[model samples]
Structures are given as C-alpha cells and as structure tokens.
Target: MTIVETTSEVEAVVRDTLAVHQSFFLATSGSAGPWVNGAYFAETGLFTLSLVLEQRGRSLAAIRDNPVVSVIISTGSPTEPFLQAQATARIVEDAEADEVRRVLLAKVPQVEPFLGTPVAAVELRVLSWRATDIPNGWLPGRDLYDTSIPVAREHRG
Candidate 1:
C-alpha cells in the first residue's frame, strides 16, 4: 500500500470515508463531565458535519456547555481503520436549519419525524483529522482545511 502523504490524498481518504459511512461517534464534555454517543451525520463539503440531535440529550447538553468535540467515523469492521476528527459544534437555526434537515434527511430519511419537536440541528466545523491506519503508519492529525500540500492531478488528453 502506498503511503498517503499529500493534502489531496488526505482529502481523498476523508471524502471516501464519509461517503461510505452514515453514522459516527461524538465525544463531548460539560459540567456533568464527559460523554460519548453515536449519531447519524451528513457532510457538507469536506469540513462540516451535520446532525439532528435531541435537545434534551446528554450530547446536546454537553455541546451547550462546551462546543468542542471529537468525532469518529468508522467502517464498523474490526479490521478496517477509522477516521477521527476534532471539531467545533454549534446549533443550527433559521434558514440553516432547513438546509441541515434537507441534507440529513437525504442521508437518513427515517429522521423526519424527529425534526422539530425535541430535536434540533447541530453543525460540527472540523478543526483537524487523522486516520487510525495509513499505508506507512498512522496518519497524524492535520488542519481540516489545509491546502498547502500539492496534489497530483490527472490531465485528460
């Protein structure tokens, strides 16, 4: 296996991981202490992940106290590696809520009934990410939006 070392390579890995997975683990902390929960999520571009969370849930309460979070997107197979990300989360409101709902429902339609009542939209702005396993070794976490490294592009003749 070739080592993934470039920014584009990292982006490709992240994009591919998100494409195949619908749910991820969210870790948060608050006055009540730390908590981790699984949540269905949808991605917008490469750095933003969205979810509809129950307003009264522990995860939401943690977010209310501390917006920082860590997320894990896994293939669920014991042998496969997982993607880990650190993010800043916030509640989505007004027009943005509608868009969040649309994106989420497109990925997980069963969540429709939970839209407004006790559930609300939250967006996680990714700060950095790393993969559990890469070709050479574990890939170290890097800026979520880093575009400094050059990526090889294919040119069609």
Candidate 2:
C-alpha cells in the first residue's frame, strides 16, 4: 500500500481517527515531574479537543503549571494504529465552561456523576500529530505537524 504524506492526506487521517475516538491518553509534566492519564474528550471543528478534569488531579495540576501536553487517540478499529498528538492545553474560562461541559456530556454521558464534582474544563489545541501503518511494513508511516507543510484547502467543493 502507498504511504500518505501530504498535509491534506495526514489531516484527513487525523480527522477520521479523531471522529472515531472519544477517549485519549493525555500526558503532562509539572514541577513534580511527568504524568499520564486517560481522559474522555470531545472535539470541536477539526483541531480542538475538550475534556473535563478534576480540579486536583496530577494531570490537571501539571497543566496548570505548564500547558504543553501530548494526547494519543486510537482509530478504534482493530486494523488501525494510534494517533499521537502534541498540543497545548488551556483552561476554559467560566464564560465558556458551560458550553464545553455540554459538548463533553453529549459525547460521554458517563461523565455525568463527575460533573457534579469541582472540575476544570480544558481544551487542547493540536500542534502536531503522527501515525504509523506499519503492519509488517506493508504501508509506510507518517509523522507531521502544523508547520511540517503549508496549510491548504482539502477540497474544492
């Protein structure tokens, strides 16, 4: 199989993968060191991911101290691998918290109980991502970021 390398190609894969995955692994670091946690997420537009975190978790604390974070999302298909994204995290302001929570609930209803607890609404701005399709080397892998290639329209319609 041919490898996908163009910016649009990579974006398409990333979009598709994100569409099929509701949860991802979030990695963060703070003065105490590094932490990784699984979180249920919701996506807005093509590049933003939103999630709610307990106000006092290590991951949340790390994000408060440093916004840089990484997220890994899988396509949820046995045939596909995972997508690793490097992103910047930001706490949603009170003005937008309700809307963010609404979106998150729509995607993951199980989070309802946790919502009652004090939590922070966070948004992850994707900076770059990578995916590998190396099933015995049948297809080459691709690693790309926002600056890896010039942004271009994906469709003419």
Candidate 3:
C-alpha cells in the first residue's frame, strides 16, 4: 500500500477512490427517520458529487428536510481503502439539470436509461473526509481533511 501522507496525497486518494467507485451508501435523517440507500454518483468537482434521485423517494424527502448527510464509498474489502465523508446535499435547480445530466452520463453511462424517468439531480458538497484501509492503518489526525478549517491564518505583524 502506498503511503498516503500530505494533504495533496490524501486528496488524490479521495479522487481516485471516487473515480473507481460507481456507487456509495448515503445516510440521511428527517421526519421519516433515518434512511440509508445505495446511490450511483459522479464526481462533479473537488469534493462534490452528483446523483439522479427518484423524485418521491424517501432519501430525497429526507434530504429536503435535512441537507446534512453522510456517505461511504467502498468495496467492503478489508484490504482495500475506502473513504467516508460528511456532506450537505441539495436538489439541483431545473436550469442546472441538463449540465448535471451530461456530467452524470459521462461518468455513469448506465444511468442514461433512467434520465427520462421522474427524477431530480442532487448535488452533494462534501465537508470532510477520512480514508481507512485496515491493511495500511490510519494516521489519526493526519488522515483526515476538513474543508471547514481555514487553510492558513492571516498574520498581522
């Protein structure tokens, strides 16, 4: 296993993980209670993913009430590395659906057949992430990235 040190390396690991994984488990909670479901995703940007969700699905309803969510992307192999992320989600605007649709199909062509169905494009903005591989082990704080933190503090001398 390659040593995953440094923020850039961690980011690369995340991008690589997202690129190879076609689906992830999304967990959400709202009035309907907690719900976890498999969702096909496409990385639309740095720390961002897009999905086409059924309009009336419980997942969508939960997301509508509570945008906060968590996702796990993994093959469930102990030796293989996997990432877990906390993200905020939102339903894409109608004007943006076409672009999201194009991007989604580019990465997940299998979704093409469902594009015409009654579904809405959802975007997930990942807040933080951590990668864990039982074989490689974790470096605690070094292995986690949180976007909410300021990269650098302004120095007033």
Candidate 4:
C-alpha cells in the first residue's frame, strides 16, 4: 500500500476509497435522539457523497430536524484504512433530483431497482474527514482534513 502524507495524496486515497466502497454508516440526531443507518453512497463531488433515503424514514426525519451528520466507511478489514467524516446533509430538491439520481446510478447501479420507489436522494457535504493512516503504520491514528475552507477542486463529480 502507498503511504499517504500530503493533502493531495490523502485526497486521492479518499477518492479511491469512496470509489470502491459501496456503502457507509450514516448517523443523525432528532427529537427521538440519535440514529444510524446503512446506505449506499456515491461520490458526488469533492468532499461530497450522495445516498438515497426513504422520504418518511427515521434517517430522513432526523436529517430534516438536523442537517448535521456523521458518516463512517470501512473496507471491512481490520488492517485496512477506514474513513469517518462530519457532514451536513440535505434532501435533494426537486430541481436537482434528476442530476443527483444520475450520479448515484452511475456509481451504484444496484440502486436502480429502488429508483422507482418513494426514495429521496440526500446529499452530504463533508465538513471534515478523518482518514486512518494504517498504511503508514499508524494503526489507530488518523489524518484530518477540513473542507470548511475552500480548496481547489471541482464541485460537481
């Protein structure tokens, strides 16, 4: 495995990880307290991911109440790197649903079966990311990247 030490290198690792992972854990909070759900995700842009959610589901309801969320994606291996991030999520508006669907389908075709169902696409813009540096012998250590500050990257995937 390649050792990642710079921001650009870490970005590449993140992109690669997102490209390969099919699902992630999404955590949200609401009047009912906190909740977490597994969902398929597609990398939609720099520090961004998109997933489908039931319009009236707990996760969506939580997101409606609080846009802030935590996400975790792993390779499912103890020695492999994993990713955790803090993000702001929102249900895709009707105006952009089509485009978001297109992007989601391009990455996760298995989701096509549910596209006709009453599902809404939710967009997650990561505020900050913590990526494990396992490849560099940092077993539990993670390198942090903040996206709150503008970076030179395209907004659209």
Order of quality (TM-score): 3, 4, 1, 2
User: How do all models score by TM-score?
Assistant: 0.81, 0.80, 0.85, 0.85
List, in order, the clash count of every candidate structure: 0, 0, 0, 0
Best by lDDT: 3
lDDT-sorted candidate list, best first? 3, 4, 2, 1
Better by lDDT, candidate 4 or 3: 3
lDDT tens digits, residue span 1-157, model 3: 3544466777777878888988999999999999998988888876788998889999999999999999999998757778887788989877787777888899888988888899899999876777775665554422444445443112111
- Assess candidate 1 and give its TM-score to the true structure: 0.81
Question: In model 2, which regions exceed 4 Å deviation?
Answer: 1-5, 75-79, 136-140, 147-157
Quote the lDDT for 128 in model 3: 71
The residue ranges of model 4 lying beyond 4 angstroms of the native Cα positions read: 1-5, 144-157
For candidate 1, give the lDDT. Answer: 0.78
Report the C-alpha displacement of residue 122, candidate 2, in angstroms: 0.3
TM-score of 3: 0.85
1-157 in candidate 1: lDDT tens per residue? 3434555666777888888888999999988999999988999868789898888999999999999999999866535657887788999898998898999989888777777578878999876567555543545443334343222012101
Candidate 3, superposed: residue stretches over 4 Å from native: 1-5, 139-157
Poorest lDDT segment (10 consecutive residues) of candidate 4: 148-157
Q: Which lDDT value does model 2 have at 134?
A: 50
RMSD of 3: 4.6
State which candidate, 2 or 4, has the greater lDDT: 4
Report the candidate with higher TM-score, 1 versus 3. 3
